[model samples]
Target: MTLHCLPSTDITELPATVSNSTENPETQTTAPAEKSAWKTLSGLLPFMAPYRGRVILAGSALLVAAAATLTIPTAFRFLIDRGFSLPANVATDASASATAMADSGIAAGQVNSVFLGLFAVALILALATALRYYCVSWLGDRITADLRQAVYSQVLRQDPVFFETLRTGEVQSRLSSDTTLIQSLIGSSISLGLRNSLLFVGALGLMIWTSPHLASIIVGLLVLVVVPIMVFGRRVRKLSKDSQDKLADTGALANETLNAMSTVQSYVRENMESDRYSQATNAAFDSAIRRNRNRSYLTALAITLIFGIIVFVLWLGAQAVIDGRMSPGLLTQFMLYAALVAGSTGALAEVLGDVQRAAGATERLLELLHAQPAIASGKQSLVASSTADVAGLGARVDFNNVNFSYPSRPGEQALEELSFTIEPGQTVALVGPSGAGKTTVLQLLLRFYDPRSGSISLDNSAIDSLKLNELREAIGFVSQDSVVFSDDVYANLRYGKPDATDEEVRQAASDAQALDFIERLPDGFNTYLGEKGVRLSGGQRQRLSIARALLKNPPLLLLDEATSALDAESERKVQMALERAMSGRTTLVIAHRLATIVNADRILVMDEGRIIESGNHQELLAGNGLYAKLASMQFNAAEFHPAVEAVRVANSPC
Candidate 1:
């Protein structure tokens, strides 16, 4: 079940202070306490600025509609006073009676004319209202679309560090629920508030013109009603923000659980997960109810105070009419204006609530939109070298005394003052225990995270100096946990190269040993892979991932346990394919299985975030270091199936 964007109410005023997520360097600080809700909402002005003409048109139409509505009571006053009141006793005599009948008929015509005039005013109001709604709604849809797009774009540009603190579910909540509140504000609430505000002012003015004393009394009483409502509204805004945050929390919990459904189900924790989700939703529900309760109280109090003033004013008007201080028609007009004022006041109270809620939503979204990623692109781009040039002298990689720590774990280093180098077209393997900084090397090379000290150079140029896109685009990566998008096979392959031809994709798939399985699938290349490629086997998904990288055909390839999922036979076959693919490329392999990297030109055995040994397979074995121990443990162990054993035997001569 999804949480909806709920409109909230207000209580006492509180300071608005929103904190930005830590990963965003620019917006990581808290907003000032004194900032008002209206000021927070003003952030949307940039989104609305492009639609200025439509806003003006809508505003003009609103003004016309309100004016037309106000004119109707004036028409009513004229109809009552002029149409019924006539020459005294004109209908008494025969000839006089005939003259009186003619005069009466003319009066009837005047009444008909007044009714027609009222209809014309009503028609104008309808047209103007329609125009206003169309324009306002169009602006709302357009602005919301732009805002969502802008926020999503900003989200895409964020790096891994950003996601470390801000969960995917929370971001999704802001994108959906928060944007929805802003849409409601722009489409419905703001227009209604403006229209009602105009009506209130116009009605109050006419009331004053009709009876100065009565209007003055109402104006004073309305001030009393408004002051408390404003106080309640501020509190409602804070509660609304709290409620939205709780809803976001529920979304985060559901998202985390759903994404790891297999893990939850495997552990037989369905009921436990359900209970967890239930608690989160209940918390959200409780928050919403609390916010809504305050809103209800405010609503009740507003209606009571506003109508009570209207009743008192009506009583005063009645007295004035009875004392012959006011005419019946004028009293009728005054009463209509008073009713308009009362209705507008009530509506404005609700609009104020909506505005406060939207202000909270706006503040949340602005935090995201204004976020600046700590990892930004550089101005320089990698010069595209020829495939032959790469094959002959592939991209040179050099790391010098680099030290780093994950932003979330600032105290513990993920990589020490380590150093490494790869010559062009060389294949290097890092075989070590888990958390030995093997994958960290690949990530550093990818520039996913920059080192704390020292520099990495690519072909004599600093990787930091190169544009992130260009740097990453020059390397192909396949991780242990292969990621496959929920799309057709052909589309997934084409994702590596958007403009890749069908033949190129098929060739890449064949090279990665994925073509056979892909062909056997229901629709061949067009088969729909389920979310995260759940429709495919572990080995098949890896093959697809490998194919994507092969399609990219970058100067450097990094495979982190790429063949870890394959069966003995599939591993042998893919091993052959990988061998052929690596012939003319610089490659970095992170493997726990020594059999996979037995033929590497060099192997860097790492432990505790530092490389302890580096040499060819034979040299490392002769050195009798961590590499030799690991190789012996693997080759002697029953972990190697016959096909994998053959691969190791063929690549080694002890």
Candidate 2:
């Protein structure tokens, strides 16, 4: 997937705009506009597109169920009017026919036929209802699974900068909790809502057919009920959004603390962290309580209003029956239809609440799916000029008049006109004070971020013009903080070179002095390293990282304070391995210890952002420059001075 760069400014502003409301001080606010509910519902049609067949089947089943449900009241009407008490004229004829037919033995077959028909109707209704439940349930499961997968895939495709803008916990909450809510709406709520809607309409039609006078009263009451629902619907949506936000905040808090448990323990701030997490959880719990209260109130109000009107109308029908204006059977049927309509209205209200919540979740997801990356891919591919040309195959990096500032701190430039060169097959050591843009230079080389004003190139090709994956694949890196996964030693080493053979991995481990430790482990190469390799010593982890780099075997090697964490003995062993790895490769080493890079082909002393001095160890020492001063402060001149001098002599023309 090719990602176009979005302005960093725009990417930073998205979270602010995606939120629900600004009025509440507790929640982030987004711009508000009144859009149609149906329009919002229709937006989700894309997610449902793949499961159209299932939806159609479910819809058909629901229709069948609704039809059967609607017909049930009619059957009650038949049983009451015919089986219990027939009409005046029919009653007289039935009595005469029963007596005359009984004499001829004919009425028995007629009664049996009527009972058989009723039994068949009941059986059909039961079977249809069962089928409806099965089909709708299946549809819900299938559609929700598809939706979850789609959302997950979209999240995975996003660039690293996109993740930086949103909390990992928040994203995870949306995937699990938020998606589950939407799934409930899709799988059950929606089906029930539609079925109830059909029941409401069918019952209303039947009521009018049975007695239009009473139907008018029912319609008038429904209009009153709708007014309150519409008014409260907006509030329900806003609160639901608030509740979700608070829950996400709680999740973010917990996730952050758990990921950094070691740091929390080291600082002895466990109680402090726990208190903060508890506060977040309490806030979420409070919001949830308020949300549930509001929903319950809405439901209670709806049911009370609907049933109150229904009971009043039923009382009027009973009075009509007493006046002999309507049959008892007809009145019973009307009451049943009225109950159906009233029940459906209550269900519909609940569905409205769910739809509103799902809409909020959908909007949140859409905001992420539409988010853009900070870095754009270049138009042209970066190709090596030729295999024979060493400089052409590897990069001759020249940071010419470079100036940069972190996007987060636009006010301060981290690097200013930092010009330097790392020739092909030449190891250049960058020595600098803290915050001297050493790491920033490495970031630029990896194209994690572009310089504010300068060009970086590989061979003669601009770095930006190269495909990002291709550019990164050509460079091997070993940082001070090496990441180790909770996997076997062999798997961790092979992470750098997935296709590397077993022998190649063993050879790299041997070179890094990690093989001796691995052999001592219970399972040798298969020993599982605990999370972040906590079981291994800092030096052992560093050696594993070195082994990883050796396995990758990229043409250009970057060692960013790689040996800073190792003890003297481990450092010596790893340094030897590094020297072997750097041979025949373009190497850039960032070091604070002056002794490690004294044998480098060139050394660049950096302060703040610019290069302060550049020369070999002896030349810089002879000149008594910043490099010499740094060397004097960091290394034992009496012991390491001869080694520096020897390197200078060997390189000084034959």
TM-score of 2: 0.85
| Residue lDDT tens for model 2, 442-552 | 888888888889888776677888888777777889998988999999999998899999999999999898999998988999999999998898889989998998898
Instruction: Looking at model 2, report the run of 10 residues with the lowest lDDT sum.
Output: 5-14
* Per-candidate clash tally: 7, 1
Write down the worst ten-residue block by lDDT for model 1.
1-10
lDDT of 2 at 118: 64
Measured by lDDT, the strongest candidate is 1
lDDT of each candidate versus the true structure: 0.81, 0.74
The sequence of per-residue lDDT tens digits that candidate 1 reaches over residues 497-563 is 8899999999999999999999999999999999999999999999999999999988889999999
Show where candidate 1 strays beyond 4 Å. Answer: 1-34, 85-106, 384-392, 643-654
TM-score for each predicted model, relative to the true structure? 0.91, 0.85
